[model samples]
Target: MEINIASGLLAALGHESRLAIFRLLVEAGPDGINASGIGEKMGMAPATLSFHLSHLSRVGLIEGKREHRFIHYSANFAVMDELIAFLTRNCCQGIGCLPKSFACNTPEGTSSQHGETC
Candidate 1:
């Protein structure tokens, strides 16, 4: 992921309501939850939920699909994975500076000195 994309994703997650909304969607998995369900779960007004959902969707953190009269929202896991990888990339540098456990935490079977799971 590019810096701009990462920054945008972070910015979308920066807001409290948006963060809560995103977290809820992630927990809901690929099937996602509808706008009303999200509002009910978050205790947000319909308008407020719509606004936050739009912001999250704009940043590619979430995706909305029309299912009849309701718009279902789901977490975009691919973008999320990209952001995670980008942030943790080159974490401890290639060296013998980290412990075994730390290296084990890295994703893709790679090891990081600080135990950063990419």
Candidate 2:
């Protein structure tokens, strides 16, 4: 991701409400949850949730689709991965750097005993 885009995402996540909203969506996975479900789970007002969701969607961290009468929100895993990769890309850039394999590089469909796959 470009620095400006990364910065925008970081800034959007800097807020507590936004972070919470993002996490909730992340935990919900690609299938996602609806706005009202999110508000109920987080105990937030509809207007407040709408504001937070807009910021997250603007940053490409979350995606929303209108499903019948409701809008469902899901975390954008690809963007999230890009942000993570960018942040950790130069973790050990200089001499005696850790091997590239030391960095996280999990493949899809790799099952985790914890019932989560990253």
Candidate 3:
């Protein structure tokens, strides 16, 4: 969760295509989706999908595992969790100014209760 690491993650996701790819992978969950499936689902060419996938993998946002001839990509949930915690670490300034219902949503769209810090 260092600044450089967080910055790299954010920068990698800054692009529209990469963001979409990441979102799709996040939605795919731990089992992930293969390269062909990702490209097909996103309507992206193989080369374009490869580029985005490489970038995401380089930044540690996504991980690729070889499953026979295909490579399955899944979001790195640990890194994602760290990034989320880092972003929301200072929320409410420790004074609880936000409502009690205020919570941070993980990549899976599930709400995580935040006591004082994320």
Candidate 4:
């Protein structure tokens, strides 16, 4: 992940609404969720949700596919994984720094529990 691309993704997630939307999509997994479902779950107005979704999509953090009249959104896991790899590439200066019991069992780009990439 180049700095510019990473910066763009980070900027898109910088907004509270966008972050929430991304997290929600991650939780929804590969199946994804439609725009209306996202708005309903997040208690956001359609316009507000649309704006955030557009930003996220533009940054390649999320993707949308048309299914009937609804557009289902899901996280772009490849980009997400690259971002995580970039961020942690220098962890502990290439030395094992975490505790011995600390196992990063989390999926490539997601949280430990349900696979939510940071």
TM-score, per-candidate, Cα-based: 0.80, 0.79, 0.81, 0.82
Candidate models: Cα lDDT each:
0.86, 0.85, 0.86, 0.85
Q: What TM-score would you give candidate 2 relative to the actual structure?
A: 0.79
Q: What TM-score quantifies how close candidate 4 is to the native fold?
A: 0.82
Predicted structure with the largest TM-score when compared to the true one: 4
Give candidate 4's error at residue 23 in angstroms: 0.6
Tens digits of per-residue lDDT, candidate 4, 1-118, equal 7899888888888888899999999899989999999999999999989988998998899999999999999999889899989888888897745443333444454444434345
Per-residue accuracy of model 1 over 50-113 as CA lDDT, tens digit each? 8888899888999999999999999999999999889777767844455566567656545643
Taking the tens digit of each residue's C-alpha lDDT, what string does model 2 give over 45-107? 998889899889988999999999999999999999999988877766733443334332445
Model 1 TM-score relative to the real fold: 0.80
* Between candidates 2 and 4, the TM-score winner: 4
Q: Rank the candidates by TM-score, best first.
A: 4, 3, 1, 2
lDDT comparing candidate 3 with the true structure: 0.86
- Highest lDDT: give the candidate number: 3
Candidates 3 and 4, the one with greater lDDT: 3
RMSD of 1: 5.0
